[model samples]
Target: MLYSIWRYRHFILASIRGDLKGRFARSRLGAFWFILHPLAQSLIFSIVLAEVMRTRMPNIDSQAAYPIYLLSGMAAWGLFSEILTRSIGIFIEQASAMKKIAFPRLCLPVIVWGSALINHVLLLLAIAVIFLFFGHYPGFAWLYLIPGMLLISIMAFGIGVFLGILNVFARDVAQFMTVFLQLWFWFTPIVYLKSVVPEKFQFLIGLNPMTPLVGLYQDALLFNQRPEWMNLWPAIVVGFVAVVVSFMVFRRASPELVDAL
Candidate 1:
């Protein structure tokens, strides 16, 4: 798979560019739409929940703390969700092209991953600018975002490809995932602080693979503190297992994928 991807590297890059172009081809604002959703969400939450949650932020002293915290979590969650969402339907969406064209099937997920990564980087830049506007500046700890986001993307990509293959066989898988992701969002503590959750429910939050990853983003960007690396172990383990399983499933499923689509 790696060799095939490398051999078709140019095709993947072009496909990514084409996907981005087609996404905003009709919109005047173009790429701004990418950041607008999350930015608007951050603003709405800042207005509605800031005061209620501001005091809950233990060590953060800034009045903009909650907004910054929200954006950080949003940034992490948005990337993971976008990849998973797009990936789930990619094979079916490209069914016609897949039937007629001879490109590697693996290329589809790679394109989704690359395109989502570009959009995510833009969102991060927007959040960084917002941080400055709030009189907040990132320190050395901000570097944690690199590993943090990489881990997130890998995990999302793995699980997404796995689910994408399953969706090709069972159409209802797509619908179920849509509802599941919405619930998953609330469970991840993106809009609300984890510290605010009751202790009895804390273990439930911890069971979520995304909690530690999102917390890493909040710690690094919102609080300007180094993330607790040990916390990422579970996500790391899950990501590795997911990626390995995805490859195995994809290899076994590839023969039947086009027919199902």
Candidate 2:
């Protein structure tokens, strides 16, 4: 167990370094795109959904502040969705490296999650700037976003690791995940607050671990409130279960993964 963790740690560092290098390998702005991509998405979504469309369901109260609301949710959703989507094909893409390298198979998704995290951090910084410009700087409660971000990453990593390994034997898993993530984005409270959902539907939505995960971010950043412990506990539990199951599956499949490639 200890050895696996150590090996994964080494591979994670190496993968992160490689990711940063590749991310800016040819760009003049270099790492700046990390900030720009999310910011651009937030800007466009905010404008189209909040301004031009003037869209809001019947239940949401803060229609005026919906842009920041949606931005907060989208930031976390984008990270998870991107990692989940990309990690699907990681083993196939790195087939040569996997065949030759002695590193742990688990490291592939971790690396992708780590790189996505860099982008998420940049998005958070941009969110802070946006809030400041809007005259709504987040308070100390915003620190909760650190733990919230960690939870989201763990959730993404667990799912990604499972999918990455599975993709080796079933190429169709990657294609399915792309469409699934698109449907998932809407199911999650990215554009609408959970409060807007009816009480009966709330439990169904809560089944998706992301519902509470985004709630944590919104609580910390947008509302300046502490995370709802009752709401967050389920997502944490789901994430924990995902990690254990993913690790077991990945470990069992690692030897086969190399052969499949």
Candidate 3:
């Protein structure tokens, strides 16, 4: 698969480039628009909930803490959700190309990852600039974002490919994820601080694989502290498992894909 991907690298890169430019091509914001949704969300959440949860939120002792904290969590969540949501429909959207062209089908997922990675990096810088706006500059701990984002991307890519393949059979899978991701977003503690959640309810949040990952982002970017790797390995394992499952599903689906489509 890797060799196949490498063989078709030019096509994948071109597709990704087209995807980026074609998005918001007429708009002034263009790619900056990628940062708007999360940035707006962070502002609103901070304005409404910041004071209410001020004393309770863990890192809210500073004036800029809540926004930074919220943005960091959103950054992690956005990357995963963007890939998963877009991936679920990749096959459907690319049906014409897949049927008419002779390119590697796996290139679609590669394009999604390439686009999402660029989006996340842009969002990260946007978040950092916003932090400066609030008079806080993130420290060296921000370097942790590289590994942290990569881990989350693995999980997102795996799930995206799995769902993208599944959606080729049942269109409803795409519809279901629209609702599911909303619930997933709320479950992720992007707005409310995890420290504020009660002990009994912590287990529910823990069940969410993204919880620790989001916490790790907050710890690194917002708190300027190192993440505890002991807690992160479980999510990493889940990511690996998802990748394995994705490959299995891809192998199974590729054989009948044309007929199914």
Candidate 4:
């Protein structure tokens, strides 16, 4: 699979380029919309929830504390959601081409992954500028975003491919994922600080693999602190297992994928 994907590396890049062009062909703002949408979400959430959560936020002394924290979490969540959601639907969305074309089927997901990384890079750059405006700089800790994004992409792709194959057969998996992701987002402590959760409910948050990942992001962007590596082991273990298992399942199911679609 890896060799086949590499054999068609140009196809993947060209598909990504075409996708970007087609998506923005009708819009005036074009690529700027990618940065604007997430920034706007962070701004709106900060405005509406900042006062209520301000007292709860700790360790950060800046007036822009809530916005910084929200943006950090959003950045991580944005990439994860974009990759997972797009992956789940890609097989179905490209069913026609898959039927007619002779290209490596894995390229569909790779295209989505590539496009998502581009959007993520743009969002990070925009967030960096925002950090400058707020007089908060992550400095050396900014390097953490690299591993953080890679971890997120791996986990999202794994789970997405597992479900995307199922969705091909069941169809309902797509509908179910829509609600699941929304609930997943709220449960991950993106909008509210984890410190604010009740002690009893804190255990629930701890059960979520994303909790620590988001905290890793918050530590880097909001506090300019190194992540508590001890806390990340569970997510790392889970992500690794998910990727392995999902690939195994995809390999077994690939022969039937075209028929299902």
Q: All candidates' TM-scores?
A: 0.98, 0.89, 0.96, 0.96
lDDT tens string, model 4, 1-261? Answer: 889999999999999999989889989999999889888998899999999888888765678988898999999999999999999999999999989999877788889989999999998998999899888875899898788888888888888888888889999999999999999999999999887788999989999888888888988988888888899888888889877887888889888889988
Off by over 4 Å in 1: none
Judged by lDDT, which candidate is best? 1
Candidate 3's TM-score = 0.96
- Per-residue lDDT of candidate 1, residues 153-211 (tens digit): 99999999999999999989899999999999999998998878999999999999899
Off by over 4 Å in 3: none
Q: Which pairs in model 2 have colliding backbones?
A: none
For model 2, the stretches where C-alpha displacement exceeds 4 angstroms are 51-64, 198-200
Estimate, for each residue in 89-202, the C-alpha lDDT of model 3 and write its tens digit.
998888888889887787898899999999999988888887898888889998888889899999999999999999999999999999999998988887887777889988
lDDT (tens digit, per residue) of candidate 2 on 1-261? 437767578668877889889989989998878778767877777777675334443444554467777778888887878787778888899899988888777677778887888878877887888888777777999888888888888888778878888888989998898788888888898776666678988777978889988988777776788987787887788789888998899878877898999
Candidate 2 weakest lDDT stretch, 10 residues: 52-61
Give stretches of model 4 more than 4 Å off: none
Models, CA RMSD each: 0.9, 2.7, 1.2, 1.2
> Poorest 10 consecutive residues of model 3 by lDDT?
52-61
Please list all clashing residue pairs in model 3, or write none if there are none.
none
